[model samples]
Structures are given as structure tokens and as C-alpha cells.
Target: MSTIVFAFSIFCGWLIFDVVKHRKLTLESLVSSLVIAVVAGVFWWILDLFF
Candidate 1:
């Protein structure tokens, strides 16, 4: 479940960033998206482990 959530969050982050900046997906958006996604995923996973 956490893995699914992580993947979904990454997709959402990318979509939002792309929409806000370029109105479409771009290579630059992918880099930031991955970064945001990884950080968010790790945080979520840690929280899940605790609770």
C-alpha cells in the first residue's frame, strides 16, 4: 500500500508541477518530480513503519 501511495504521489507531483510551470510535461519537470517523489516516499515509509 505504501509503495502504491508513493508512486501515485510522484505522478501527482509531476502533473501538478508540469501544469503550473509549462502547461505540459517536460524533461525538467521529471527531475524535480523524481526528487519530490523520493523524499515524500521515504518520509511516508518511515512514518508507516512507526505507526
Candidate 2:
């Protein structure tokens, strides 16, 4: 539950960062940010499982 929320927050936060940096949103930016967020979420999940 919290992990899911955190993943979404990461996505949103990354998207906002890209938007601010580029001054626009595009498919590339969206996908890149989403990929990064997913990777972070997966890493966090694995860590949670271990510890």
C-alpha cells in the first residue's frame, strides 16, 4: 500500500522535475521518468523483501 503510493509519488515527482527542466512534457520525458520511477520502486521492493 505505502510502497505503491511511494512509487506513484516518485513518478509524479520525476515528471514534475522533467517538466520544470524542459518547460514541456513529451512522450520521451514521460517514458523516461516512468522508467526511472519503476526501477526505483522495484529496488525498494527488493530491499523491503530482504530487510
Candidate 3:
């Protein structure tokens, strides 16, 4: 749970950075960030489970 939360926070940070750098927040960016976050969380979870 904590790991998941941490992943989410990191995602939020990335999203914010993208928005700031681009000077506009778009739906595509939001969706991509969500997708990336999910993939990263899954990868981390699997790694933690195995090692």
C-alpha cells in the first residue's frame, strides 16, 4: 500500500512538471501519466514480490 502510494505521488510530481514545462495541462498528458504510473507500480510490485 505504501509503495503504491509512493508511486502515485511520484506520478503526480511528473504530471505537474509536464504541465509546468508545457504551460498547459492536457488530457493526453494526464492519461499518459496515469498509464505510466500504473506500469511503474506493477513493475515495482513484481520486483518486490520476487526480490
Q: Candidate 3: give the clashing pairs.
A: none
lDDT of 2 by residue, 1-51 (tens): 757777899999999999999999999999998998888889888888899
Q: What RMSD, rounded to one decimal, does every model reach?
A: 2.1, 0.8, 1.2
For model 3, residues 1-51, the per-residue Cα lDDT tens digits are 966996798689879988998999999889888888888888888888898
The clash count for each model shown is: 0, 0, 0
All models: lDDT?
0.77, 0.90, 0.86
Per-model TM-score versus the true fold:
0.66, 0.90, 0.83
User: Which residue pairs does candidate 2 place in steric collision?
Assistant: none
Residue 27 displacement in candidate 1 (angstroms) = 1.2
- Candidate 1 — worst ten consecutive residues by lDDT sum? 2-11
True-structure lDDT of candidate 3? 0.86
The RMSD (Cα, Å) of candidate 2 is 0.8
> Model 2 scores what on Cα lDDT?
0.90
